[model samples]
Target chain A: MVKAVINGIPIEVEEGVTILDAARKAQINIPTLCKHPDLTSSASCGICVVKLKKNNRMFRACCTPIEEGMEIITHDPEIIEIRRTVVELILSNHPNDCLKCGRNNNCELQKLVADFGIREEHFDKFVRDIPKDSSTGTIVLEASKCIKCGRCVDVCQNMQDVWALSFLERGIHTRISPAGDIKLADSPCVRCGQCSEHCPTGAIFEFDETSKVWEGLMDPEKYCVVQIAPAVRVSIGESFGFQPGVNLTKKTYALLRRLGFKAVFDTSFGADVTIMEEASEFVERFVHKKGTLPLITTCCPAWVDFMEKFHPDMIDHFSSCKSPHEIMGVLSKTYFAREKKIDPEKVFMVSIMPCTAKKYEITRTDEMFASGYQDIDVVLTTRELARMVKQAGLDFAQLPEEEPDHVLGDYTGGGVIFGATGGVMEAALRTAYYLVTEKQFPKVEFENVRGLKGVKETSIKIDDTKVNIAIAHGLSNVEYVLNKIREAKKNNQPMPYHFIEVMACPGGCVGGGGQPYGVTDAIRTLRSKGLYAHDDAMKLRCSHDNPFVQKLYNEFLGKPLGKRSHELLHTDYKARPVYRK
Target chain B: METSVVPDIANVVEKWKDKKGNLIMILHEIQNQYGYVPREISFQLSKLLDVPLARIYEVLTFYNYFKLKPPGKYTVSVCMGTACYLKGAPELLEELHHILGIKEGETTKDGMFQLEIVRCLGCCGLAPVVKIGNKIYGGLKRSDIVNLLSQYSKEGAPVAQPV
Candidate 1:
């Protein structure tokens, strides 16, 4: 351990810990803008400048490691002046359209300026006249609002390994853009929105489709119906003054009804149906030797798009199941419409997801139009729903807890855990074991495959045979797992694993690109805990045990992987060009 | 939109394949050959080098040395450094535009000449300098631009020395 004195307070920290972290241990708040808990500090923003006691040399607290017996002064009059000048320079170039920005109240830079008590502009305003790029239709890039902090570039290049965004120039002329001044849609971007999620300012943000949803809600002829993803329930509470990861599923159902939805459904129920088809498909591939080994999960749309572009050779390994929300969408227009006697054409199916990629997934393939109409009419992120609740002037905290509709609302504990990494693997295993053994596994919880680990590998015993499984989250971590499969194929060796699960965003959908802003590893843990607690509280813990799913198969659709299920619940994928041009 | 890789460009890309941080050097070579980095070459280089086209473009556009469009037969550059600007460089540029029927950073319809504005060509001793290809004319007036164009038109080709 290294001992350091921060602001006259003595503290002991592990060796190589940054002074910012040491000050945090001493309970001193060192302000920062470019530093995020999820990324390595680039020290681009000089807001966290500090002084060493012996030589009085100035250093950035974020990147400077604490030395043994070193004395550091985090804040003083001189330090405050330097930090203020840094912020003033950044503000001079930043746009003054905060009130009209998409990240109006939730912006990091705006909060920092307010904290520093900056009342007036100290420098002459010289904002750039760069035009906005809304080519992706899922995320918008307002280049003028960028502070040139390089956080978004780090997340895109280093974290996500997408390299779709980069600094176009050096010094003051530097602006964030896709390579070659091309539109983002024409670049190699998968529309994950991780760049937007990591941006400290309003420069990058999810495309606002709330106004279109509002128009559909106000139309008298349109029967507006909405479904909520499992991840949305845990994270939406952050916008309502509740702690992060507080489960508001029932209250959200009541709120959606108040917001004028004809019926509210749970995406977890669609997840249960997905498990039924996916687990059966796994059995066919693993036990029956029907198709490719190591069947990869196809729940996350961003992962699907990434696979289609970067790893097209692995297309044979991808499961044919549509994502849960798309399944819910097609079902809403078909089974729900037939059951409720509503016209499929008039049903405006809206999906509240913790994903921006869902907006792109709605028109991704022709199977998305399986119900003879557009499956999902509109897709809104968890942040957008929070905005609508505020716009409606509804008191979300005071609303009594209610239930979702009967047929499509009921879900199992296995379905609820789909929001976290390795969740789909655990849920699928619970049913895959039953299909192989024809009996309950007794212990349904697979503790081996749960957590925030980048890649998790485990094995389960079914009867006398051992089933190998692997799960990976975050797109960068996927390369290692895929390389193993490619190596095996090259050597003509036995398959490494029977099943694989991949989620594009880190920590799965709970830490998705369209979740609430200011997410960290701690926040991901809390959100994962919320889903697990909800899962543990439920009576049915397995997907095959959900009675409503069975009823849907018996009454409306046939069995799992049957003719009707194939027509509506399954889809195909093809290789796509990296650039759209 | 035509992204088929040419054999010569492919050879150039292959030469730089093993070198670290060779994007700028390779782009310089492309610019030297074609007078500018064409869109098709940029796309093909992205595929051949396995680098994101965005990253390549970021390097290509960030420096003022790289161009994206084809240059004309005779390239004209007006130095707009502090010394040249104070000596009425804008008037000279306006007159050149009038004679060539093209704006800065553009080629004439006849493909005879292209106009550009640059910072210091290291000849500040001769303030208000204009360079056509390898020949440099220093201390020029607005009226001199017409005479300069007439000399080139009469020769029907670029002269090795300034008139």
Candidate 2:
């Protein structure tokens, strides 16, 4: 432990702890722009500069490690003035269009500017006239608004391993763009939006489609129905005054109803259906030897895009099931509409997702049109849904709790846990074990496959056979698991694992790109805990235990992987060109 | 798409394959060989070198040395340094553009002349200098641009004199 004096207060901290963290432990907040908890400190932004007590040499608090018997002054009149000047210099190059910006009040730069009370610009204004890149159709990149913090670059290249966004040029001429000045849609972006999530300013953000959703809702000829994803219920409340991870599923349903949706469904129900097909497919492959071993989950669209672009050879190993929301979209227009005596054409299905890639996933393949029309007409991020709630003048916090329509709204504990990193694997194991052994395990929680670990590996015994499993969340962590599998295949060794689950974003959908902003490890844990808590409180804890799911299989689809189920729920994957000519 | 260029680019990439931070050096070689880094070459390099196309372009566009388009046979560069700027270099550039019918960084449609602006040529003593090929024309006026450009024109292929 190293003893440090911060702001005249002495404290003890671990050796190698940054002064910023040590000061944070002492309850002092050092302002930072480029330092995100999920990324290593580049110290590109000098906003977190602090003074050493003896010689008073300036040091960046983020990158500097605490030493024994070091006295540091984090804040003073001179430091505040210097910090304010730094912000002013940044603002000089930044556009004064915050009100028109997508992040608006939610932007971290805007918050810091407000906190520092920067009312007047002291530096000469010289904003770059760079045009916006909206070609991706998932996230927009406004180069002129970029502060050159390098957070997005770190997230895209180092964290997500997408390598889409790169810093072009040096000095003031530097700007973020695809590696070769090509359009982002033409680059190997994969539309993950992790860059946008890590961005501090309005430089990168989700492509706004809320107005289109509003138009669909206002159309009299259209019966607009909506479904909320599992992760969304736990994280959406962050936009409001509610604490992070507070379950807002009931309130969300009520708000969607008040937002003029004809019906509100839960994606957890779709997740339940996904497990039904996925677990049966796993059993058919593992027990019956019908297909390849180590069936990978395809619920996260960003992961699917990554797989198609980078690992097309693994297509045979992917489960042929549509994502939870896509399943909900098809069922909303087909099963729910036919049962309710409504026209599927007029049924506009909108999915409120915790992902930006979900916007891209709606029309990815022909299976999305299984209901004879575009199953999901509009996809809104959790941020977009929050904006709609605010626009509708509904007090989300005080909205009376309400239930979704009975048919597609019912879900199980296994379905609700599909939002976290190891969720899909855990949920699939619960039902896969049951299908394999014809017996229910008393302990349902797979503790080994939980938490925000980059890569999690475990083995579960189903009757007599040991089922080895590996779960990787962040895209960067996926390469290790994939290389191991490749090594095993090269030597013709026994399969490294029987099942693998991957989510593109860190901590799965709980830390998804399009969720409410300001996500960190603490927030991811809290949001995941909220999902597990909801699962624990549920009566039915398995997908097969959900009575409505069983009814859907019995009445409409004959079996889990029957002809009708395959037509309505399954999809195929193909290798895609990384760059479009 | 061009199969002939693949082996050449692969050889260039092979030279820098073992080195760290070799993207800029590789791009410099590609630009030197082709006079500009073509999009197709960049795409091929991305595949051969196992680097993202975006990262390659990031390096290509960063330094002003790399160009994405071909240059003209006889390049005309007008110094726009501070000394030249005060001595009507901007007017000289405008007059040259009018005569050549090509903007800065662009080649003529017939592929004879290209116009460009340079920060400095270290010739402040000869303010407002214009260089075409190997010859330097210093202390040029706005009117001198047309005659200087016409000398290189196909119709008049007269032997030009350095000012």
Candidate 1 per-residue lDDT over residues A1-581, each given as its tens digit: 99889989999999999999999898899999999999999999889999998888999999999999999998889999898888888999998688999999999899988888888997998888988999888999999999988888988887887888899877888889887667889887888888888999999999999999999999999999999999999999999888988999999999999999989999999999999999999999988999998999999998999999899999999999999999999999999999999999999999999999999999999999999999999999999999999999999999989999978899999999999998999999999999888898889889989899999999999888889899999899899999999999999998888899999989999999999999999999999999999999999999999999999999988988999999999999999988776
Which candidate wins on TM-score?
Answer: 2
Show pairs that collide, candidate 2: A179-B54, A179-B55, A180-B54, A180-B57
lDDT of 2 by residue, B1-163 (tens): 3434543877888899989988888888888898988888888877888887777777787788898777888889999999999999999988877877778988989888878899899889998999987688899999887777777885545477786
Q: Give TM-score values for chain A, per-prediction.
A: 0.99, 0.99
- The interface root-mean-square deviations, each candidate in sequence, come to 1.6, 2.4
Worst 10 residues of 1 chain A by lDDT: A179-188
Q: Candidate 2: misplaced stretches above 4 Å? A: B1-7, B94-112, B122-125, B153-159
User: Which pairs of residues collide in candidate 1?
Assistant: A179-B54
Model 2, residue A461: C-alpha shift (Å): 0.6
Q: Each candidate: how many clashes? A: 1, 4
Interface RMSD of 1: 1.6
**Per-prediction TM-score, please?**
0.96, 0.97
- lDDT string, candidate 2, A446-546, tens digits: 99999999999999999989999999999999999888888989999988999999999999999999988889999999999999999999989999999
Give per-residue CA lDDT, model 1, range B61-149, as digits (tens): 78988987788878899999999999989999999988888998789887778898989988988879998877888989998888787
